[model samples]
Every structure is written in C-alpha cells, then in structure tokens.
Target: MDLAMLLAVAGLAQTPAPAKLPLPVELPAVANATADPTCGNRPALAERATCVVSTQAGVEGVLQAYEAVFTPQGWLVADASGNVVIYMKRKPEGGCDAFQVLAFADGEMAAPAAPAYLAFATIPRDICQAADPNAAAPAQ
Candidate 1:
C-alpha cells in the first residue's frame, strides 16, 4: 500500500474516545449555618436545630440538631433528581422516629431559616423501617 493510503487507513481505524458524562457532585456545606440561640436553653426536643444539606437533587435536612450532625454517622438517600431523602441511622428497634424531614429546595443546602420539623404523627411508619423492603421485595 502507498504511505499516504496506509496513513489514512490507520487514522480512520483509530476512533476518538467517547465523551464522559460528569460524575454526580456532592452538596456543598451551608454557609453561616450557626446554632440558633433561641433553640438554646429550651427543652431537649425544642432545642435541637435541624441541619439541612441542600444539593442539586433537593434538600435533605437533619433534625435532632447537634453540630456537624451529618458528619461521621448518618444516612443519605438521593432521588433521581439528586434530591436527598435524608435519614439518620435507626436507633435500635425504634428506628428513625426521633428524626424529622424538612422542606425540599433547589440548591446545595437549605437555608438556615428553613422549617425544621415535620409533624411526627404525619410521618409514615414504613419510613422508619430498618430495611427498604420495597427495593428488596420480589417484583410482582
């Protein structure tokens, strides 16, 4: 084969690599999310400040507020839109009854002023279940 023809064939044989989709990024920490003084000196239940971790998907706020509540040990469940369905680790068999779900928002984290708690009675019992049986259940 001619040198020019060989070179052309070789070039054609080498395809460019496929472009990569960007990996999902983690939500950034909330700016200036400090403890609320009003919550201080109140009863335990009322004193806790919910920390909302906002992301592209949605807001995942954690109630039962302690500083750095989501650090080290916590559970984060994201929806298709990247919204986090936040759940703290269940406490023994009682499960996650003690926690609360805040509002959903579009951003990296919910604003400090976001609503902190949902009505306890309104929360579904299954949300506190230890395992996600629906995901594991056999398809009908």
Candidate 2:
C-alpha cells in the first residue's frame, strides 16, 4: 500500500481535523450571546463567547440540526444540563486543549418579540474541562 493508504490504515493520518464545532445557522437580527454571568468575569484565563440564531424552529428541530452539524466535524455530546446540551472535542490549537460547544433553545426568554432563540456557546478547552463533569475524557 502507498504511504497515504498505510497512514490511514494505522489511524495516523495527519489530515487536519475541524478546529471547532460547526456553528448553528443564525436567523435574522441575531443578537450576541453572553456567558452564564455567575462564573464571574475572569477574562485573563479563558475567553467565552456566544452565538444566537432566532427562528421558529422547535426544540428537537434545533437540537437535531446542531447534532448533524457537529457530528460531521467530529464533535460529540459530552453532557447536558437542563435543556442545554454540551458537546466536546479535542482541539489541536491552544496546546492540544479541549474545546466545548453548548447548544440551547428558549422561547420564553425572547418574549413576544423573537418568538424563539437558538443559542450556542464557544468555550475554551481549559474552561470546558474545569466546568464539565463529562470532561472525564476527550470526546471521540
């Protein structure tokens, strides 16, 4: 077998994996997502950011869409809190740190204005490990 084929067989291919989880589609007039807030603002150690998509989609619809997007990129669900599901994967950047994605849906929070909001968070690898109990091991 050729060198490329041999590497693939050995699971040693150097192909670059997706750096992060696939971002959910953002609907019109989307707003910036914020952190849990209770974690306090410690920007020096790790950074946190959120993305929101406004849509009329249902809970399952939103969750399924994210699963499809993240799965293809090698992201796996790590843990779920209430309605917010957390996914994690090993990231090559940031010194082989762990990356995390949090997907959630809320209709009431937006009130009679947005109708529904699909939100997700991009958390630093170190931050994810420290915060998630499911961080026992890297997601396959």
Candidate 3:
C-alpha cells in the first residue's frame, strides 16, 4: 500500500478513544434545613420536619415526649406546665425541614431556638409506603 494511505489508516486507528469522562455521577439529593418561625403554624410542612427528626433520632426516648400533632401533622412536646414547647415543620418546596424549640424563660414572643432548622430532602414517599402497607402513597 502507498505510504500516504498507510499513514492515513494508522491515523484513523490511533484516533484516541473518545476521551473517557467520569460517568456523570448522580450524587443523591441532600436536604438543607433552616430555622423559620413563620412556619410554626403550617401543618403539612411541620409534620414533615418532625418526621425527619423522628427518623434522625432513631430512638424512642428522645422522641417520647413529643406527640405527633396532626392539625399541623408535626411533632409537639409540652412542658410540665402543659404548654406547647417544641414545634417542627417541613418545607418540601424549599427542600428542607425545620424545628422550633420554644424558650419559656424568654418573654412571650421568644424567637425560635438556635439550629432550630434541620433541612433534609423529603424521603421518597415510596420508601415509606413500601415499608408500611398502611402508609399512604405519594400523590401523583
């Protein structure tokens, strides 16, 4: 074969394999939480936050005092005086959930406690449903 033709064929064979690119690693979505007193009264969101706490605690003792309040369908714990002391809420749209630990010593309108927010992406509804047959499936 002609030298030019041989060189051309060799060049084609040497075309470096398409530069391999790290497979687009799809990192799992992470939930970001923050404090927001404005959400104290929101129900759905609150429950979601409390759920995150319940899941994180992974223990019954710390969560024993808190009751699952459905009005806002979140977690609530009352002090010995029977006052709502802690509140938790979730913001699915915001990709986070938050908790409000009330301060009784402080005056009536005490700001939410520090690190009051714990944000986490909502756990896939399917996970809950699959784990518990009674769990309601996420709305389509």
Q: Which candidate is the best by TM-score?
A: 2
Off by over 4 Å in 2: 1-49, 54-57, 92-114, 127-140
lDDT of 3 by residue, 13-113 (tens): 23333322221111222233323332233343333332122122221222232232222354232221222233334345432232333211112232333
User: How do the predictions measure up, each by TM-score?
Assistant: 0.26, 0.41, 0.17
lDDT of 1 by residue, 10-31 (tens): 2211344232222122223444
lDDT of 2 by residue, 3-117 (tens): 1211111111233323334333232331332223221222211233333333333334545655676677766777654444566666565222333333323322323223233
Best candidate (score: lDDT):
2
Candidate 2 lDDT at 132 equals: 58
Candidate 3, residue 86: Cα displacement in angstroms equals 17
Q: Which lDDT values do the candidates have, in the order given?
A: 0.30, 0.39, 0.27
Q: Candidate 2 at residue 83, lDDT?
A: 44
Q: Given candidate 1, what's the lDDT at residue 29? A: 41
